[model samples]
Target: MSNPLGGLARRASFIDSVRQEGCGVCIVDAGDFIAREGRISDKNSIQLRIAAEFMLQAMDRLGYAAANVGEGDLVFGDSFLAGIAEGLDVQLVSASVFAGGARPFAPARMFTTAGITIGIAGIAWEGFTPYVAEHSDPGRPMAMAATADAMREGLEEIAGADVKVLLAHAPLSELRILLADIPGYDIAIAGHDTNMEPFAEPELAGATRLVNRGWDGTHAGRLDLTFDRTGALIAVAGSAVLLDAAWPDHPDMLTLHADYLARVAAALRDILAEYPVSPPPTGTRYAGVQSCVTCHPVQWGSWRQTTHALAWQTLVERSRDYDPECFACHTNGFQWTGGFTLYEDTPAMAAVQCESCHGAGADHCDAPLLPYSRPGEAACLRCHVPLHSPEFDYGTYLPKVAHPKAP
Candidate 1:
């Protein structure tokens, strides 16, 4: 996963550079600031909650002016959100989100910087109600008003401001229609389109300039606004900066990250204890690397020379050996029957061993003729997905680990 701490550091550096150039900066998030939109599960709930808390704290430290309320933020319910918001320096705004027929956050917020007032209004898509219904707490049910109605009301509320911006947690098509119909917003920052990639140029929805930084904190959208002597908006330029390894990690964010990791590790240890590993049934049990070395010495030696043998060591070096997500791919038969559980508890299954590719060898060892699984494209693809192994090619990668059968 991409580290948010690194992204925050880069953002802080960018902000400092802009301010040093004698330009005023107003930082705001379009939406989805709490967590990613998905079902909450026992395995991930702890990590997600901790991550959300860290994100809020980091935003406060960065001095964010405002952030939109996306549907994902409702996963923890209104009470949890309210508790967190109470301690935040960032203003959370949404024109549509309501509970008990009343809006939970401000309809819009105004920020004055360098003698110009900027009005920002937040709006969530009406279609996100289904997501909220499925994942959100049933006790504190929320409703989304009509998008057009919300936009009109929000625009009317911020009419007196010099520049009007819409922070919308909706798709581009929806924003286009609303911006065209509303006809007032000078700029619109659209979120919720996960598939869209960040672009340098902004799209026009009527007269409003539309921009989206995409998801996952991989990039930050930048807009340079130029106003005339009368403070009337004259020109707008937009671009996106990639948050990569080039930027050094900010000291403060690094400290926050370490604290988050330590807390998550403790929570994971408890979760693992609650759900202890259950051994697989007879005939399909995983046989460790040592069990196969005697029978197929050549294959065992070949495997030891490959990167798969040292996968667990890589996680250990990075202090992620205990992380279930990272361990699943790095170790042998993770979460499977008789597979890896805790690192210290199951040291034999530490790395991708012979059984990781071939089927569990208990039956194979007992009866040599019994069919055993051979490594194939399907087997490799399970771990070599685009997110983790983007350059993986079945044809080219297969040869690197090819081993001869017994003569």
Candidate 2:
């Protein structure tokens, strides 16, 4: 799992280096900082809420100027989001999003840095208006206005700014229409387009220069704007800097991460205790790796040498062993009936095992020729998704994990 802490650490270092150059800097996020909907089921809402809270606290610590509110941030409802935002220094903005016929956050904010008065505004996609209404608290119904109309209103409020920037939480097609309709923005930072490759160079959308730094915290987009003596914007340049091992982890963020792990672990433990793993239907239970080793020693030995065997160790090293989201992929049969639950109770199901791919093997073990499932591309995709394995190619990867058939 790629924890945000590593990227945040690199960002901290990168920001300090930029400050050393004697240039004024401002930090902002495009939004969708929270986890996706699938990760926050009723069973694990408490754990994810703790994570969301930590994310906000960390953003405040980093001194973020502002962040847009994307759809993913609404999974917990507007009242929950508002309560958290009230305690943070980072301003949450969205011109399109409204609660009970009123805007939940300021449409725009002004920041004067390096003799430049910059006005930044945020707007969500109108297409997701229904989603906003569905997820909002019943007491405070949320609504979204037309994207272009919202952008126009937000930009109008900041018309006097020397430079106008927009944080647009919509797809590229919609963004083009918005820029075309509302023409004053100097720069637009795109969000909610998960498929977009990080823009190494800004794309011209009418008079506005649009940029996106892909999804996840793997990269940070840097846009350097040059203005003439009269403060007229003259040039714009952008690059996506990958947050990798080259940068050391920031001490402050590391402390925060440690606290997060401890708190999340404690919460998960309580949740698990309250709701014990239910029994799987008769004859469908998992028969751990030990059961397989007795029947096919060669395949079992080969599997031990593969990365899947050590998946659990990876999480342990990063102190993320307790996170249910990470736990699901790293361990076998997590959240599934008669599968992995707590490590102490289910040590045998600690890592990806034969049953994880072939389905629960208790029935298969009872009768050798009972027609066991042979996992195909779809099975691998369940765990090797884009976010976790962006470079995964089914053809290239299958061969690496292939084991000889039983004699």
Candidate 3:
């Protein structure tokens, strides 16, 4: 499985379920368990660092076999990963990401369970090349070799194991190509690329079985393999477990989750308190939504009934009101000139107010006849892009909030 992104609520339960089967369990992550963009603060921010610590602690408790050192995991830099790796029970492996022509983490790890020696090798996507050049120390960019070379090297390292699995954090298409060229692996888990839907069943390419369980921690992939005494391939069953609301939260992980949530909330509150939000200058052109409600009563009422009116409240409910990544979409004129900054400063601008769509209402409220650009799909796209609202369709959504001109 891949792309857990700090979600720990349902993971432990899934792991426990596998263990309950009374069979040997080898839990491995393809890549991208840690979130790259940082959770409550900027990259490598203290808040993010704290969150990462909690996440790895949960992983340790769950007893992960091995996890590939993905690009997202490296976002906090090599030192942060090294610190986590030093204490982890799980082995972190990567054949591609290197410094000074040497692999920084384990290229492969061997696990013996139920009379089977399973060898798992990890290869991160080489896409981190440009990132290394910019964020790394001067004259010391991480060396990323060609994909073929990395896979060949990794395969050779793990060739002797009874059962070989390739934890590939590379493109799905490229992994398929490698499967053809390197037929030594018995199982391959793909990651890093988009897999909105999981495979219907485990696919056999050459002698390897390929599987990928989409991005995000919403779903997990499972493969149950039955091998003969000779280590000959026999039977394989694969399916995706949807970690929805029905799945009970792991008891221990739930406590950890709540603790981190509280920690992040406190950190955000402290930050906001130190730098309270304030309103724009009086001379600015952004008159608050109240300034427009007087004349545009119908439009104002219509907006109040829409989700936009409660955008800020949603964040408050989730304790993310001050979150920079979230606040912009929920509040009016975020980061724009003369726009909302912190809640203390721009209380009137809270929620996706009129200015969020119709541009600043200061001039319009003063002169109703003045030119105001009518918003279109582009305006909605600013927040409704794929990540948050993948199903968003312009024509289908516009009429839901459309307010016809007053007769």
Candidate 4:
């Protein structure tokens, strides 16, 4: 029901599965269905923007009824949202967010399916100003009102509908507080709570039911509501469906994903060609695994025996060698000092090499005894993060690629 954050393949699978059930279903997003902001290069930013464009296009094709505008979705700014909304059959709703002194999204959207009129209103939290400002163009900025105040006003406009559902892009704690003061909506679906589990117990407030599935499109939330002709709610049930490797990918979605990747790769090539890359700082030049072979032959040989040596090959096999996002973890020194830029430019740094965890090796190569920072937990965390390797543990993994401590 929310937070599909660029997992196009799984989302497509989920959508296909849902469509098979019947036309009585209408898909709605709580929020955050785009690329998130983090440490990124200009190239990474371009890729995210392109990916967001394709995501919007895909959502339109999938037939989403209403999608709440989450903070992460503001990366492209108000104009981009407006542009996509125009081309889409889906209506982007947000009571809290305003652009150019006017609300870019409708405060509420109505959908009629199976003789039930579903009223959907969206409310985004107030702390998203910095994130949007960081990723958006300087010329354009976003504005927001108080979440509770805005949603109160929005509910009035949609009160005529049979079932009222508030898509609050805020935490459960915050939603609970807001729902107390404004008690009109029958149900609320929330996002931005990264801790929620698929089977987690739902929080109930009088007749209202609050539902959420944790972040990152790992699972999808499904809610079925049965209402009488007079708009009185008779029954309501919700569950989270896991979208894992077992789920079949929709043929159309797979085609769309492949096309999107191709376009992103082409765009990246053009951007890289136009923007000249500056050299790494004085002490930050990377030395590939080969540079360490002479000094530490045993360690180098051991590393080759591990999966780290074949990082680039995995990406190559999947045809994701050119993808900046995937390359960050698969290659050495990616987005770091004297790291990988493009595959052709930094072919030697294609795999997870010696300098990936350890500091840049130019200084060490110049002077054998030159002090180099040892790889620590933080270094491992750069790539072995939760989203990439959920089971990665520093203590457990350190022994796998352990080498002699530098004196």
lDDT of all predictions, in order shown? 0.79, 0.81, 0.73, 0.76
- Per-candidate RMSD, Å: 3.4, 2.9, 4.7, 3.8
Q: Write the per-residue lDDT of candidate 3 for residues 196-218, one digit (tens) a residue.
A: 46672778767788988576666
Evaluate model 2: give its lDDT.
0.81
For model 3 the TM-score comes to 0.81
The reply for model 1, stretches above 4 Å from the true place, is 1-9, 273-285, 354-368, 374-407
**What's the TM-score of each model vs. the native?**
0.86, 0.91, 0.81, 0.86
lDDT of 2 by residue, 81-111 (tens): 8788787888888898888888878998887
- Model 4 agreement with the true structure over 185-300: per-residue lDDT tens digits: 88888887766654424568655787775676677788877767776788777877766566666778878878887987788776454334454433568777878888888888
Instruction: Give per-residue lDDT, candidate 3, residue 287.
Output: 73
Writing each residue's lDDT as its tens digit, candidate 1 over 117-156 gives 9998999999987776565456657888888988988898
Highest lDDT: which candidate? 2
Q: Model 4 shows how many backbone clashes?
A: 0
Ranking 1 against 3 by TM-score, winner: 1
Record all residue pairs in model 2 with backbone atoms less than 3 Å apart, i.e. clashing. none
